[model samples]
Target: MRRPVAVAGAAAALLVALTGCSLGTADAVPGAVRVPTGPAVTPLPIPEVEPSGSAAAVTDPFRRAADGTALPVLERTPGAVFADVTQADLCGPRYSAGVRGERASDAEEAAAAYGVEDSSPYTTDHLVPISLGGSNEVSNLWPQPKEGAFAAAAKDTLEAHLRGLVCQGAVPLETARQALVQDWRAAYDTYTARPLATPSPTAAPTGGDGGVVSGGVCATDGEVVRSPEKQVRLTCRPDAEGVLRWQRRA
Candidate 1:
């Protein structure tokens, strides 16, 4: 009772499945929060709307805080690729752009050489964040320090999107999700390949003792010279004296 057509069709279907599926009105999941339409103020007051009968009722997981809210979580659907949290730069002080991993230290040095203070090495990022159904993941995210950037532009756009849906009455969670998915992909492709405004220079460190000392330098952040020696071996950080002291290696 083996069918070759079934196997071939299944293989063909797999090839077409590149991205994940978004939610829709007819396919709203349980516990989904339906957003309202209107202008979003700083306080971000929640709007009143009737809940869908079949929709699952749970605390609004996508609710953002007034100041620094945690990003929303996007669950993977049956046929879609879930948004990867590992891709986010947790160490950066702002949003997408501040990811030191995204740019090299030499790039920063080049920016400094060009008389640019705190050179911008920001990458486009999701504002509402791709996980929470914010569209144009690329468009939703903008360049700012990954650590310090807020949801200003992204929030404004999201609020407008939500308000429009709410104003029309009976906004479905799935509809919002689809809109966000479409927007993010479009924006992502647009900005991913754009050129940087400031170009990095290819110059080496200027004339100096060349980091390496005669005897050896202490491997630390900030320390003072303990013993007198021509050569010093310096490590990343020493103590808190600002000046690095040298010590012979064993």
Candidate 2:
């Protein structure tokens, strides 16, 4: 709690110093955190992520979490992935009608994939947001819940800082996007200069835990939690078998 509050302040200060945006403002959604920068700090490289310790090899975008779930899993890859971007991409129309239609029609399906009963509270959000060169492909989207530790707002804070870094040319645009896509929570941890929150096998997992929990999770979770005692949260979504596997993400 103490660290993140300070993290929040530092992130806020970083954004203020770099983007000149108010301390806590996000035009898309509001929450600000500081990003690390310096005259010669190189863009952070991809950190090793152990996805599942499975037989299959995994890429940076896909890793096994502590709970042994494959992660950064996409719905499917977009036909056209965005490799180039500018600051202007953030404010444009989010998804094409076709993409929107897919999101709308599959909203419930997306929710079900996570064992959530209803898709209403979970937003059909982009895995890598459009602001940072993410595409509107189904693979790029997921049903992100609005509540819990790594709620939509929390991701927004990371996005705001990353966007600031991109706009300021402090980090390579592609690196920022790739780092987020690889493991957003890891990226958060790296940039914020914090250690991973210790996982509690007995305590429930937070949506923001950035790791999976007991009974093992379906996928590596990236939601960043404020405290270790607070369980990592996952929405009320059902697993592939249609059994509700998770609880209210807190």
lDDT of each: 0.32, 0.49
Best candidate per TM-score, number? 2
lDDT of 1 by residue, 1-250 (tens): 4699899878766755642343232455779997884222121112333343333224432222334332322221111212332222211223223222213444343333233355344433333433333333112323323343343344333433342232233344344444433343333233222221211211212113433442233333223332323434433221111122232322
Q: How does candidate 2 score on lDDT?
A: 0.49
Error of 2 at 8 (Å): 78
Question: Tens digits of per-residue lDDT for model 2 on 1-250?
Answer: 5998999888878978898667456565456666764222122233454445545543333333343333445324221235444555542334222222344655555555556567667667666665565665455666665776656766665665565455544566667677776766667656544221222434444333433433333322333222334544544222222222243443
Cα RMSD for candidate 2?
A: 24.1
- Who wins the lDDT comparison? 2
Where is model 1 poorest over a 10-residue stretch in terms of lDDT? 198-207
